[model samples]
Target: MASSSRSTLYENLKLVDTVAKVKTTVKELRRQKEISVDCEGNNLSREGTLDILIIGTVNRKVFLFDITKMGVSAFDAGLRDLLESGCDVMAKLMYDCRNDSDALMHLYDVKLAGVLDLQLVEIDSRRKSKQNHWFLKGLKKSIEVYDHDEKSERTKKNGTEQIEDAKRNGTTIWDKRPLSPDLKDYCAVDTVKLFSLLKVFRKKMEREKMLEASERYVDYFRSYETFPETKFYRHGFLPDEILRSNPRDPKVQYNDCQGCKKKFKRARLDLVNAGEKKRANFCSCCSRIITRIENQPIPSQSFA
Candidate 1:
């Protein structure tokens, strides 16, 4: 039986904080062939820290790990290896995986393999049908049919409210020690639903002959490098033609980073080439400083 505080869906869930537990969990999970994965981060930006990592097998065995609890070095080597490479598992499923993959790379300096984002599959299927619609949907809405538990009633009410509060405050709720039961339920549901959604999405992809496209889509995002947000493109706002028209002009103007006053040439042209126009001029140094601020942990405390 699940603890009364937890939903029945997570009654069998395990929390892995030790190297030994991670090793054993990976061994057992590999036997299941596939897993669904999700993560909670400090922020939505590219540099955000990955604070909570969740994995669930097809059979509903779920594991939650607080990566910060042990610090990165103390984090289970087995799990890190599994995420990076040399894992027997056949596939890892996720939904809209770009942010998660970026956070993982930012935190652990590793990338996930054998990943398939269900969102990509849905998009391909919709395109094939020539139906037009916004593709982003919350996991709860996307996989509501798979949830059969009465506990979800309470979770929907409490979890949604708590998550909204965290967003409103710009607080990292996942950084709170002694994780709250409501937050735990929210995290668990996020991961567990991925497995359920994967099963359904996989079949849909195969039927529509879009399995190949889905794989390619995931690979593209995995290798993608995101540019700075549009708001940061300041001094580099010149039209590409104008910039290129005088590539050899010795008299071309140079701009300094607003924050550091460091000189850079063709800042606007650089932004344009990156598919953005300048709203402000920031040197690479100032941009990294901003990224660090966005990725700061809650409580303003250092973990190690």
Candidate 2:
């Protein structure tokens, strides 16, 4: 049986001291094992200040539960738990870990090891450059705890109407405690949905040869040089023309990654192939680069 425990945290923005409980929670989670972790950080300030809120799992349904008594300290414990868990726990994300590392450093103070950063998992996971959305986390449909395809359309409609209101009155997620319930709902769903997608993707991967091929291409982008979020269009790897692809169809015309030095098709993992294959890049290995490199580029391309 999976032990699904939960805790909630009510942040008292008035006192950073109130965040002490977050520290305690980190220690506790470290002792645990095999978890799913996700964080929502509001870029609330012009200085890029963020409110890093996380929803973690032990073994339970990916439903958003309240655990306020545990306090925000639970997040700290989560970071510790994930970091110390070593090779056993693999935390996945839909965005570049580098963008979030600043806020993350506050939780995990040291360089982490024994963790499978899906970012560094493989090269295909990386796109050729900034032009590649293949590296963008959470673009594919791994699974969903709740069917938000309906809600997604709703969010779009609401966002369109809110655009005018947003312009008139800027929003701040920090002072908007008890952390806007709307934000909370969005955050929790994204995390749970990621888990749902993972469960389905893993099963699908085991059954389909083609889907596994896609994952290998996706894995290539997960390396030190590639920004896991947007591997294609590395800072200076490719030409300006290739840097510009049809956002509507990036896979068909994306840039060559500095790492792989080849074309990467990103749209393979778009909405069209959700149930059929794990949305990601396709094969583009340069045999010469494959042979010349000391350390291989994100070569997690698995073809069996």
User: Highest TM-score, which number?
Assistant: 1
Q: 138-247 in candidate 1: lDDT tens per residue?
A: 45666665444556656767977877898899776777787777767777776777766666666556532333433343333334454434433222221111111223
RMSD of 2: 13.9
| lDDT value, residue 202 of candidate 1 | 60
**Superposed model 2: Cα runs more than 4 Å off:** 1-20, 42-47, 58-85, 89-96, 106-171, 204-304
Tens digit of per-residue lDDT, candidate 2, span 38-96: 44433421124335444444343232212233333533545444543434454333322
Q: If scored against the real structure, what TM-score would every candidate get?
A: 0.65, 0.43
Supply the global lDDT for candidate 1.
0.57
**What is the lDDT, from 0 to 100, of the residue 160 in candidate 2?**
38
